[model samples]
Target chain A: MITRVDHIGIACRDLAASIAFYERTYGFSVFHQEVNEQQGVKEAMLRINGTDDGGSTYLQLLEPLHAESPIAKFLERNGEGVHHVAFGTADVVAETEAITGTGVRALYEQPRHGTFGSSINFLHPKDCQGILTELVQSPVHE
Target chain B: MITRVDHIGIACRDLAASIAFYERTYGFSVFHQEVNEQQGVKEAMLRINGTDDGGSTYLQLLEPLHAESPIAKFLERNGEGVHHVAFGTADVVAETEAITGTGVRALYEQPRHGTFGSSINFLHPKDCQGILTELVQSPVHE
Candidate 1:
Protein backbone atom coordinates (compact mmCIF):
# COMPACT_ATOMS: atom_id res chain seq x y z
CA MET A 1 0.00 0.00 0.00
CA ILE A 2 2.82 2.37 0.81
CA THR A 3 4.47 3.42 -2.44
CA ARG A 4 7.30 5.64 -1.28
CA VAL A 5 8.28 8.24 1.27
CA ASP A 6 6.35 11.37 0.40
CA HIS A 7 7.85 13.88 2.79
CA ILE A 8 9.33 14.14 6.23
CA GLY A 9 7.43 16.70 8.30
CA ILE A 10 9.52 18.99 10.48
CA ALA A 11 8.10 21.34 13.09
CA CYS A 12 10.10 24.50 13.62
CA ARG A 13 9.75 27.79 15.46
CA ASP A 14 10.75 29.76 12.38
CA LEU A 15 9.79 28.40 8.99
CA ALA A 16 11.84 30.87 6.94
CA ALA A 17 14.93 30.33 9.06
CA SER A 18 14.76 26.55 8.64
CA ILE A 19 14.13 26.97 4.93
CA ALA A 20 17.11 29.27 4.69
CA PHE A 21 19.34 26.78 6.45
CA TYR A 22 18.30 23.90 4.18
CA GLU A 23 18.67 26.03 1.05
CA ARG A 24 22.02 27.39 2.16
CA THR A 25 23.49 24.07 3.24
CA TYR A 26 22.07 21.62 0.70
CA GLY A 27 20.85 23.72 -2.26
CA PHE A 28 17.26 22.59 -1.69
CA SER A 29 14.67 25.12 -2.81
CA VAL A 30 11.03 25.47 -1.84
CA PHE A 31 8.65 24.09 -4.46
CA HIS A 32 5.33 24.72 -2.75
CA GLN A 33 3.89 26.53 0.27
CA GLU A 34 0.49 26.71 1.92
CA VAL A 35 -1.37 27.46 5.12
CA ASN A 36 -3.77 24.82 6.41
CA GLU A 37 -6.20 26.43 8.82
CA GLN A 38 -7.53 23.09 10.00
CA GLN A 39 -4.07 21.86 10.86
CA GLY A 40 -3.04 25.36 11.97
CA VAL A 41 0.31 25.25 10.27
CA LYS A 42 2.16 27.32 7.71
CA GLU A 43 4.03 24.76 5.63
CA ALA A 44 6.64 24.82 2.87
CA MET A 45 7.40 21.79 0.72
CA LEU A 46 10.86 21.42 -0.83
CA ARG A 47 11.72 18.72 -3.32
CA ILE A 48 15.21 17.29 -3.00
CA ASN A 49 15.36 16.92 -6.80
CA GLY A 50 12.84 17.47 -9.54
CA THR A 51 12.10 13.95 -10.75
CA ASP A 52 9.00 13.26 -12.80
CA ASP A 53 8.48 9.72 -11.57
CA GLY A 54 7.58 10.89 -8.03
CA GLY A 55 10.69 9.12 -6.89
CA SER A 56 12.26 12.08 -5.09
CA THR A 57 11.24 12.78 -1.47
CA TYR A 58 10.46 16.09 0.20
CA LEU A 59 11.19 18.04 3.35
CA GLN A 60 8.08 19.65 4.80
CA LEU A 61 8.82 22.61 7.07
CA LEU A 62 5.91 23.39 9.37
CA GLU A 63 5.33 26.40 11.62
CA PRO A 64 2.45 26.68 14.05
CA LEU A 65 0.09 29.53 13.30
CA HIS A 66 -1.42 29.80 16.79
CA ALA A 67 -0.70 28.87 20.37
CA GLU A 68 -3.41 26.24 20.49
CA SER A 69 -2.20 24.47 17.39
CA PRO A 70 -1.07 20.87 17.77
CA ILE A 71 2.25 21.71 16.13
CA ALA A 72 2.76 24.46 18.71
CA LYS A 73 2.51 21.88 21.45
CA PHE A 74 4.95 19.60 19.61
CA LEU A 75 7.46 22.44 19.21
CA GLU A 76 7.10 23.40 22.88
CA ARG A 77 7.94 19.88 23.97
CA ASN A 78 10.37 18.60 21.34
CA GLY A 79 11.76 22.00 20.30
CA GLU A 80 12.35 21.67 16.53
CA GLY A 81 12.89 18.39 14.70
CA VAL A 82 11.20 15.74 12.62
CA HIS A 83 7.55 15.68 13.57
CA HIS A 84 6.32 12.84 11.33
CA VAL A 85 7.09 10.63 8.30
CA ALA A 86 4.55 10.48 5.51
CA PHE A 87 4.23 7.61 3.07
CA GLY A 88 2.91 8.04 -0.42
CA THR A 89 0.15 5.80 -1.80
CA ALA A 90 -1.83 5.49 -4.98
CA ASP A 91 -5.21 4.92 -3.28
CA VAL A 92 -5.72 6.59 0.08
CA VAL A 93 -8.97 4.87 1.02
CA ALA A 94 -7.79 1.34 0.22
CA GLU A 95 -4.41 1.86 1.85
CA THR A 96 -5.87 3.42 4.97
CA GLU A 97 -8.40 0.61 5.33
CA ALA A 98 -5.81 -2.12 4.83
CA ILE A 99 -3.65 -0.86 7.69
CA THR A 100 -6.52 -0.04 10.00
CA GLY A 101 -8.01 -3.50 9.55
CA THR A 102 -4.84 -5.00 10.92
CA GLY A 103 -5.70 -3.74 14.43
CA VAL A 104 -3.90 -0.44 13.79
CA ARG A 105 -6.06 2.52 14.74
CA ALA A 106 -6.59 5.28 12.22
CA LEU A 107 -6.31 8.87 13.47
CA TYR A 108 -9.22 10.12 11.42
CA GLU A 109 -12.59 8.72 10.31
CA GLN A 110 -12.30 10.26 6.85
CA PRO A 111 -9.52 11.31 4.53
CA ARG A 112 -8.61 15.00 4.59
CA HIS A 113 -7.05 17.34 2.08
CA GLY A 114 -3.28 17.44 2.10
CA THR A 115 -0.49 19.32 0.37
CA PHE A 116 -0.02 18.82 -3.39
CA GLY A 117 -3.70 17.90 -3.67
CA SER A 118 -3.12 14.58 -1.96
CA SER A 119 -5.62 12.87 0.30
CA ILE A 120 -4.13 12.35 3.73
CA ASN A 121 -4.71 10.57 7.03
CA PHE A 122 -2.72 9.71 10.10
CA LEU A 123 -2.00 6.32 11.59
CA HIS A 124 -1.83 6.25 15.37
CA PRO A 125 1.77 6.49 16.52
CA LYS A 126 1.14 4.04 19.35
CA ASP A 127 0.85 1.20 16.84
CA CYS A 128 3.90 2.19 14.80
CA GLN A 129 6.34 2.52 17.65
CA GLY A 130 6.54 6.24 18.58
CA ILE A 131 6.82 7.55 15.05
CA LEU A 132 3.77 9.42 13.77
CA THR A 133 2.94 8.08 10.30
CA GLU A 134 0.90 9.83 7.66
CA LEU A 135 -0.53 8.14 4.55
CA VAL A 136 -0.90 10.39 1.52
CA GLN A 137 -2.54 9.47 -1.79
CA SER A 138 -1.09 11.63 -4.51
CA PRO A 139 -3.56 13.03 -7.02
CA VAL A 140 -1.03 12.74 -9.79
CA HIS A 141 0.65 9.36 -9.69
CA GLU A 142 4.12 9.74 -11.13
CA MET B 1 26.32 18.71 0.35
CA ILE B 2 23.50 16.29 1.07
CA THR B 3 22.21 14.28 -1.89
CA ARG B 4 19.21 12.53 -0.37
CA VAL B 5 17.81 11.13 2.84
CA ASP B 6 19.33 7.69 3.27
CA HIS B 7 17.21 6.56 6.19
CA ILE B 8 15.52 7.52 9.40
CA GLY B 9 16.94 5.79 12.47
CA ILE B 10 14.23 4.57 14.82
CA ALA B 11 15.21 3.43 18.30
CA CYS B 12 12.87 0.75 19.53
CA ARG B 13 12.66 -1.58 22.53
CA ASP B 14 12.00 -4.73 20.49
CA LEU B 15 13.75 -5.07 17.18
CA ALA B 16 11.94 -8.22 16.08
CA ALA B 17 8.50 -6.91 16.95
CA SER B 18 9.13 -3.51 15.32
CA ILE B 19 10.50 -5.22 12.25
CA ALA B 20 7.45 -7.40 12.06
CA PHE B 21 5.11 -4.43 12.23
CA TYR B 22 6.81 -2.62 9.36
CA GLU B 23 7.17 -5.69 7.22
CA ARG B 24 3.59 -6.79 7.71
CA THR B 25 1.97 -3.40 7.38
CA TYR B 26 4.02 -1.63 4.75
CA GLY B 27 5.65 -4.63 3.05
CA PHE B 28 9.06 -3.29 4.09
CA SER B 29 11.47 -6.21 4.28
CA VAL B 30 14.79 -6.33 6.00
CA PHE B 31 17.67 -5.91 3.58
CA HIS B 32 20.43 -6.14 6.15
CA GLN B 33 20.85 -6.86 9.86
CA GLU B 34 23.80 -6.60 12.21
CA VAL B 35 24.83 -5.90 15.79
CA ASN B 36 27.14 -2.93 16.19
CA GLU B 37 29.29 -3.33 19.28
CA GLN B 38 30.27 0.34 19.23
CA GLN B 39 26.68 1.59 19.24
CA GLY B 40 25.59 -1.25 21.56
CA VAL B 41 22.50 -2.04 19.51
CA LYS B 42 21.19 -4.74 17.19
CA GLU B 43 20.10 -2.98 14.01
CA ALA B 44 18.06 -3.90 10.94
CA MET B 45 18.03 -1.95 7.68
CA LEU B 46 14.92 -2.20 5.49
CA ARG B 47 14.76 -0.95 1.95
CA ILE B 48 11.41 0.62 1.14
CA ASN B 49 11.22 -0.69 -2.42
CA GLY B 50 14.46 -2.56 -3.00
CA THR B 51 15.65 -0.03 -5.54
CA ASP B 52 19.33 0.13 -6.56
CA ASP B 53 19.69 3.82 -7.47
CA GLY B 54 19.78 4.85 -3.77
CA GLY B 55 16.87 7.16 -4.51
CA SER B 56 14.62 4.97 -2.35
CA THR B 57 14.92 5.61 1.39
CA TYR B 58 15.34 3.23 4.32
CA LEU B 59 14.19 2.54 7.86
CA GLN B 60 16.81 1.53 10.41
CA LEU B 61 15.32 -0.19 13.45
CA LEU B 62 17.52 -0.30 16.51
CA GLU B 63 17.25 -2.19 19.79
CA PRO B 64 19.57 -1.47 22.69
CA LEU B 65 21.87 -4.32 23.70
CA HIS B 66 23.04 -2.86 26.99
CA ALA B 67 21.77 -0.57 29.73
CA GLU B 68 24.54 1.91 29.11
CA SER B 69 23.74 2.26 25.42
CA PRO B 70 22.63 5.66 24.08
CA ILE B 71 19.57 4.08 22.44
CA ALA B 72 18.59 2.66 25.82
CA LYS B 73 18.54 6.16 27.26
CA PHE B 74 16.64 7.48 24.24
CA LEU B 75 14.03 4.76 24.58
CA GLU B 76 13.69 5.45 28.29
CA ARG B 77 13.19 9.19 27.77
CA ASN B 78 11.54 9.62 24.37
CA GLY B 79 10.18 6.12 23.82
CA GLU B 80 10.44 4.43 20.42
CA GLY B 81 10.80 7.15 17.78
CA VAL B 82 13.19 8.73 15.34
CA HIS B 83 16.75 8.85 16.63
CA HIS B 84 18.39 10.55 13.68
CA VAL B 85 18.02 11.40 10.00
CA ALA B 86 20.94 10.28 7.83
CA PHE B 87 21.62 12.30 4.70
CA GLY B 88 23.69 10.92 1.85
CA THR B 89 26.75 12.90 0.80
CA ALA B 90 29.70 12.43 -1.52
CA ASP B 91 32.43 13.54 0.87
CA VAL B 92 31.97 13.01 4.59
CA VAL B 93 35.02 15.01 5.71
CA ALA B 94 34.19 18.01 3.54
CA GLU B 95 30.46 17.89 4.37
CA THR B 96 31.17 17.58 8.07
CA GLU B 97 33.52 20.52 7.95
CA ALA B 98 31.11 22.66 5.94
CA ILE B 99 28.25 22.18 8.41
CA THR B 100 30.49 22.68 11.44
CA GLY B 101 31.86 25.91 9.92
CA THR B 102 28.46 27.46 10.65
CA GLY B 103 29.21 26.87 14.35
CA VAL B 104 27.20 23.64 14.32
CA ARG B 105 29.33 21.21 16.29
CA ALA B 106 30.07 17.74 14.97
CA LEU B 107 29.22 14.97 17.43
CA TYR B 108 32.46 13.19 16.76
CA GLU B 109 35.95 14.31 15.76
CA GLN B 110 36.30 11.45 13.27
CA PRO B 111 34.02 9.58 10.92
CA ARG B 112 32.81 6.19 12.09
CA HIS B 113 32.12 3.01 10.13
CA GLY B 114 28.45 2.67 9.22
CA THR B 115 26.15 0.15 7.52
CA PHE B 116 26.96 -0.57 3.85
CA GLY B 117 30.53 0.65 4.53
CA SER B 118 29.40 4.26 4.66
CA SER B 119 31.50 6.80 6.54
CA ILE B 120 29.20 8.49 8.99
CA ASN B 121 29.33 11.42 11.42
CA PHE B 122 26.71 13.35 13.30
CA LEU B 123 25.82 16.98 13.90
CA HIS B 124 24.72 17.90 17.40
CA PRO B 125 20.96 18.17 17.77
CA LYS B 126 21.45 21.31 19.83
CA ASP B 127 22.91 23.09 16.83
CA CYS B 128 20.57 21.60 14.21
CA GLN B 129 17.24 22.67 15.70
CA GLY B 130 16.81 19.61 17.95
CA ILE B 131 17.36 17.18 15.08
CA LEU B 132 20.36 14.88 15.16
CA THR B 133 21.62 14.86 11.59
CA GLU B 134 23.99 12.20 10.27
CA LEU B 135 26.25 12.76 7.29
CA VAL B 136 26.80 9.48 5.44
CA GLN B 137 29.10 8.93 2.48
CA SER B 138 28.05 5.66 0.92
CA PRO B 139 30.96 3.65 -0.42
CA VAL B 140 28.97 2.33 -3.39
CA HIS B 141 27.56 5.60 -4.58
CA GLU B 142 24.39 4.89 -6.55
Candidate 2:
Protein backbone atom coordinates (compact mmCIF):
# COMPACT_ATOMS: atom_id res chain seq x y z
CA MET A 1 0.00 0.00 0.00
CA ILE A 2 1.05 3.59 -0.50
CA THR A 3 2.52 5.22 2.59
CA ARG A 4 4.27 8.57 2.41
CA VAL A 5 5.32 10.96 -0.31
CA ASP A 6 8.79 9.90 -1.27
CA HIS A 7 9.75 12.81 -3.50
CA ILE A 8 8.16 15.33 -5.76
CA GLY A 9 9.81 15.44 -9.20
CA ILE A 10 10.48 18.63 -11.06
CA ALA A 11 11.53 18.74 -14.73
CA CYS A 12 14.09 21.27 -15.83
CA ARG A 13 16.27 21.76 -18.87
CA ASP A 14 19.12 23.00 -16.74
CA LEU A 15 19.39 20.78 -13.70
CA ALA A 16 22.54 22.46 -12.39
CA ALA A 17 20.97 25.90 -12.40
CA SER A 18 17.88 24.57 -10.65
CA ILE A 19 20.07 22.90 -8.07
CA ALA A 20 21.90 26.19 -7.44
CA PHE A 21 18.57 27.97 -6.97
CA TYR A 22 17.24 25.52 -4.37
CA GLU A 23 20.51 25.46 -2.53
CA ARG A 24 20.88 29.21 -2.51
CA THR A 25 17.28 30.04 -1.65
CA TYR A 26 15.78 27.11 0.24
CA GLY A 27 18.96 25.64 1.72
CA PHE A 28 18.19 22.25 0.20
CA SER A 29 21.32 20.19 -0.30
CA VAL A 30 21.77 17.41 -2.80
CA PHE A 31 21.92 14.15 -0.93
CA HIS A 32 21.83 11.89 -3.95
CA GLN A 33 22.48 12.16 -7.67
CA GLU A 34 22.15 9.58 -10.42
CA VAL A 35 21.79 9.26 -14.15
CA ASN A 36 19.34 6.52 -15.11
CA GLU A 37 20.00 5.46 -18.69
CA GLN A 38 16.63 3.78 -18.97
CA GLN A 39 14.77 6.82 -17.67
CA GLY A 40 16.84 9.14 -19.88
CA VAL A 41 17.36 11.81 -17.25
CA LYS A 42 19.91 12.99 -14.73
CA GLU A 43 18.34 12.97 -11.29
CA ALA A 44 19.17 14.90 -8.13
CA MET A 45 17.46 14.29 -4.82
CA LEU A 46 17.40 17.21 -2.38
CA ARG A 47 17.38 16.47 1.33
CA ILE A 48 14.59 18.19 3.19
CA ASN A 49 14.56 18.83 6.94
CA GLY A 50 12.48 15.97 8.30
CA THR A 51 12.80 12.24 8.75
CA ASP A 52 16.02 11.38 10.51
CA ASP A 53 16.18 7.71 9.60
CA GLY A 54 17.01 8.09 5.88
CA GLY A 55 13.30 8.49 5.23
CA SER A 56 12.14 11.95 4.26
CA THR A 57 10.04 13.76 1.71
CA TYR A 58 12.55 15.15 -0.79
CA LEU A 59 12.55 16.88 -4.16
CA GLN A 60 13.79 15.07 -7.26
CA LEU A 61 14.85 17.20 -10.17
CA LEU A 62 15.04 15.59 -13.60
CA GLU A 63 16.90 16.89 -16.63
CA PRO A 64 16.01 15.12 -19.80
CA LEU A 65 18.91 13.41 -21.56
CA HIS A 66 17.05 12.33 -24.67
CA ALA A 67 14.48 13.96 -26.88
CA GLU A 68 11.94 11.13 -26.85
CA SER A 69 11.96 10.49 -23.13
CA PRO A 70 8.78 11.16 -21.17
CA ILE A 71 10.31 14.02 -19.20
CA ALA A 72 11.56 15.63 -22.40
CA LYS A 73 8.06 15.56 -23.79
CA PHE A 74 6.74 17.11 -20.58
CA LEU A 75 9.24 19.95 -20.72
CA GLU A 76 8.61 20.51 -24.42
CA ARG A 77 4.94 21.03 -23.71
CA ASN A 78 4.81 22.54 -20.25
CA GLY A 79 8.31 24.07 -20.00
CA GLU A 80 9.51 23.48 -16.43
CA GLY A 81 7.45 22.51 -13.37
CA VAL A 82 6.46 19.60 -11.20
CA HIS A 83 6.61 16.48 -13.34
CA HIS A 84 5.27 13.82 -10.95
CA VAL A 85 5.06 12.67 -7.33
CA ALA A 86 6.40 9.43 -5.90
CA PHE A 87 4.96 7.62 -2.91
CA GLY A 88 6.63 5.01 -0.73
CA THR A 89 5.27 1.48 -0.68
CA ALA A 90 6.41 -1.70 0.98
CA ASP A 91 5.08 -4.18 -1.58
CA VAL A 92 4.97 -2.78 -5.08
CA VAL A 93 3.28 -5.87 -6.53
CA ALA A 94 0.39 -5.57 -4.15
CA GLU A 95 0.37 -1.81 -4.61
CA THR A 96 0.28 -2.23 -8.39
CA GLU A 97 -2.66 -4.59 -8.14
CA ALA A 98 -4.43 -2.20 -5.78
CA ILE A 99 -3.90 0.76 -8.10
CA THR A 100 -4.96 -1.04 -11.29
CA GLY A 101 -8.03 -2.40 -9.57
CA THR A 102 -9.24 1.18 -9.44
CA GLY A 103 -9.09 1.44 -13.28
CA VAL A 104 -5.94 3.59 -13.21
CA ARG A 105 -3.17 1.96 -15.22
CA ALA A 106 0.51 1.88 -14.36
CA LEU A 107 2.87 3.01 -17.11
CA TYR A 108 4.88 -0.16 -16.72
CA GLU A 109 3.62 -3.74 -16.74
CA GLN A 110 5.73 -4.09 -13.62
CA PRO A 111 8.01 -1.88 -11.59
CA ARG A 112 10.89 -0.45 -13.60
CA HIS A 113 14.38 0.54 -12.44
CA GLY A 114 14.30 3.94 -10.76
CA THR A 115 16.56 6.30 -8.84
CA PHE A 116 18.52 4.92 -5.89
CA GLY A 117 18.15 1.48 -7.54
CA SER A 118 14.52 1.30 -6.45
CA SER A 119 11.72 -0.40 -8.38
CA ILE A 120 9.02 2.03 -9.41
CA ASN A 121 5.84 2.35 -11.43
CA PHE A 122 4.08 5.41 -12.78
CA LEU A 123 0.35 6.01 -12.78
CA HIS A 124 -0.84 7.95 -15.81
CA PRO A 125 -1.50 11.60 -15.09
CA LYS A 126 -4.79 11.57 -16.98
CA ASP A 127 -6.20 9.03 -14.55
CA CYS A 128 -4.87 10.83 -11.50
CA GLN A 129 -6.49 14.17 -12.28
CA GLY A 130 -3.42 15.49 -14.16
CA ILE A 131 -0.97 14.80 -11.34
CA LEU A 132 1.36 12.04 -12.48
CA THR A 133 1.81 9.69 -9.52
CA GLU A 134 4.48 7.05 -8.92
CA LEU A 135 4.70 4.17 -6.44
CA VAL A 136 8.16 3.05 -5.38
CA GLN A 137 9.37 0.01 -3.49
CA SER A 138 12.34 1.20 -1.49
CA PRO A 139 15.67 -0.23 -2.48
CA VAL A 140 17.40 -2.72 -0.22
CA HIS A 141 21.02 -1.65 0.26
CA GLU A 142 22.30 -5.15 0.22
CA MET B 1 15.05 29.93 5.36
CA ILE B 2 12.98 27.17 3.84
CA THR B 3 13.02 23.97 5.82
CA ARG B 4 10.74 21.26 4.52
CA VAL B 5 8.22 20.86 1.80
CA ASP B 6 5.03 21.78 3.60
CA HIS B 7 2.66 20.48 0.93
CA ILE B 8 2.09 20.31 -2.78
CA GLY B 9 -0.94 22.27 -3.93
CA ILE B 10 -3.20 20.58 -6.47
CA ALA B 11 -5.93 22.34 -8.39
CA CYS B 12 -8.95 20.17 -8.82
CA ARG B 13 -12.50 20.80 -9.89
CA ASP B 14 -14.02 18.62 -7.18
CA LEU B 15 -12.50 18.63 -3.72
CA ALA B 16 -14.64 15.71 -2.48
CA ALA B 17 -13.74 13.55 -5.43
CA SER B 18 -10.04 14.29 -5.07
CA ILE B 19 -10.20 13.65 -1.32
CA ALA B 20 -11.95 10.33 -1.96
CA PHE B 21 -9.35 9.28 -4.48
CA TYR B 22 -6.48 9.98 -2.06
CA GLU B 23 -8.22 8.23 0.84
CA ARG B 24 -9.19 5.16 -1.16
CA THR B 25 -5.84 4.74 -2.87
CA TYR B 26 -3.17 6.13 -0.58
CA GLY B 27 -4.98 5.84 2.80
CA PHE B 28 -4.29 9.52 3.43
CA SER B 29 -6.67 11.20 5.85
CA VAL B 30 -7.83 14.77 5.98
CA PHE B 31 -6.21 16.51 8.89
CA HIS B 32 -7.51 19.98 8.20
CA GLN B 33 -10.20 21.57 6.06
CA GLU B 34 -11.16 25.19 5.57
CA VAL B 35 -12.79 27.67 3.23
CA ASN B 36 -10.97 30.93 2.71
CA GLU B 37 -12.97 33.61 0.92
CA GLN B 38 -9.82 35.67 0.41
CA GLN B 39 -8.30 32.89 -1.68
CA GLY B 40 -11.65 31.79 -3.09
CA VAL B 41 -10.97 28.13 -2.62
CA LYS B 42 -11.99 25.23 -0.39
CA GLU B 43 -8.82 23.53 0.83
CA ALA B 44 -8.11 20.12 2.35
CA MET B 45 -4.76 19.15 3.85
CA LEU B 46 -4.17 15.39 3.89
CA ARG B 47 -1.67 13.91 6.26
CA ILE B 48 0.81 11.48 4.78
CA ASN B 49 2.17 8.31 6.38
CA GLY B 50 5.18 9.75 8.23
CA THR B 51 5.69 12.10 11.11
CA ASP B 52 3.49 11.73 14.21
CA ASP B 53 4.29 15.14 15.66
CA GLY B 54 2.28 17.26 13.23
CA GLY B 55 5.23 17.46 10.82
CA SER B 56 4.87 15.68 7.52
CA THR B 57 4.72 16.62 3.88
CA TYR B 58 1.02 16.73 3.06
CA LEU B 59 -1.05 17.33 -0.05
CA GLN B 60 -3.21 20.43 -0.26
CA LEU B 61 -6.11 19.89 -2.63
CA LEU B 62 -7.71 23.11 -3.77
CA GLU B 63 -11.08 23.55 -5.44
CA PRO B 64 -11.94 26.97 -6.71
CA LEU B 65 -15.00 28.58 -5.22
CA HIS B 66 -15.06 31.72 -7.34
CA ALA B 67 -14.45 32.07 -11.04
CA GLU B 68 -12.10 35.01 -10.88
CA SER B 69 -9.57 33.70 -8.42
CA PRO B 70 -5.99 32.85 -9.45
CA ILE B 71 -6.57 29.11 -9.03
CA ALA B 72 -9.66 29.26 -11.20
CA LYS B 73 -7.63 31.01 -13.87
CA PHE B 74 -4.96 28.31 -13.59
CA LEU B 75 -7.54 25.55 -14.02
CA GLU B 76 -9.07 27.36 -16.97
CA ARG B 77 -5.65 27.43 -18.67
CA ASN B 78 -3.75 24.36 -17.55
CA GLY B 79 -6.66 22.02 -16.82
CA GLU B 80 -6.07 20.06 -13.57
CA GLY B 81 -2.68 19.33 -12.04
CA VAL B 82 -0.21 20.32 -9.38
CA HIS B 83 -0.68 24.03 -8.98
CA HIS B 84 2.17 25.02 -6.66
CA VAL B 85 4.49 23.91 -3.87
CA ALA B 86 4.81 25.36 -0.36
CA PHE B 87 8.09 25.50 1.51
CA GLY B 88 7.99 25.71 5.28
CA THR B 89 9.79 28.45 7.15
CA ALA B 90 10.16 29.58 10.75
CA ASP B 91 9.63 33.25 9.91
CA VAL B 92 7.67 34.32 6.88
CA VAL B 93 9.00 37.87 6.89
CA ALA B 94 12.63 36.90 6.88
CA GLU B 95 12.19 34.16 4.33
CA THR B 96 10.27 36.48 2.04
CA GLU B 97 13.12 38.95 2.13
CA ALA B 98 15.68 36.28 1.29
CA ILE B 99 13.63 34.96 -1.64
CA THR B 100 12.93 38.37 -3.09
CA GLY B 101 16.57 39.39 -2.92
CA THR B 102 17.27 36.68 -5.46
CA GLY B 103 15.31 38.62 -8.15
CA VAL B 104 12.20 36.48 -7.67
CA ARG B 105 8.87 38.18 -7.02
CA ALA B 106 6.17 37.26 -4.55
CA LEU B 107 2.52 37.49 -5.50
CA TYR B 108 1.75 39.50 -2.39
CA GLU B 109 3.45 42.61 -1.07
CA GLN B 110 3.21 40.94 2.34
CA PRO B 111 2.35 37.47 3.49
CA ARG B 112 -1.40 36.93 3.46
CA HIS B 113 -3.75 34.52 5.19
CA GLY B 114 -3.53 30.96 3.89
CA THR B 115 -4.60 27.43 4.65
CA PHE B 116 -4.62 26.51 8.34
CA GLY B 117 -4.54 30.29 8.91
CA SER B 118 -0.83 30.40 8.16
CA SER B 119 1.07 33.41 6.86
CA ILE B 120 1.88 32.75 3.21
CA ASN B 121 3.15 34.31 0.01
CA PHE B 122 3.52 33.03 -3.52
CA LEU B 123 6.55 33.46 -5.77
CA HIS B 124 5.49 34.20 -9.33
CA PRO B 125 5.50 31.12 -11.53
CA LYS B 126 7.55 32.84 -14.23
CA ASP B 127 10.31 33.52 -11.74
CA CYS B 128 10.30 29.94 -10.48
CA GLN B 129 10.48 28.47 -13.98
CA GLY B 130 6.77 27.67 -14.38
CA ILE B 131 6.21 26.35 -10.88
CA LEU B 132 4.11 28.62 -8.76
CA THR B 133 5.95 28.43 -5.44
CA GLU B 134 4.71 29.43 -2.00
CA LEU B 135 6.48 30.18 1.25
CA VAL B 136 4.52 29.41 4.38
CA GLN B 137 5.14 30.26 8.02
CA SER B 138 3.11 27.58 9.73
CA PRO B 139 0.63 28.68 12.35
CA VAL B 140 1.64 28.64 15.99
CA HIS B 141 -1.72 26.95 16.79
CA GLU B 142 -1.91 28.61 20.18
Best candidate according to lDDT: 1
Task: Please give the C-alpha DockQ score of model 1.
Answer: 0.53
**CAPRI-style class, candidate 2:** medium
TM-score of 1: 0.94
Alpha-carbon RMSD, candidate 1: 1.8
**Model 1 over residues B1-142: C-alpha lDDT tens digits?**
6777778899999999999999888878898899888879899999764233454478899999999999999999999999998887788999999888877899889999888777999998887878888888888664
Error of 2 at B126 (Å): 1.3
Number of the top DockQ candidate: 2
lDDT (tens digit, per residue) of candidate 2 on B1-142:
6667788999999999999988877668899999999999999999774442345677999999989977899999999999998888878888889889988898899889988778999998898867899988877421
lDDT of 1 by residue, A1-142 (tens): 6767778899999999999988766677998999998889999998863232455578899999999988999988888999999987788889889998888888999999888777999998988898899998877654
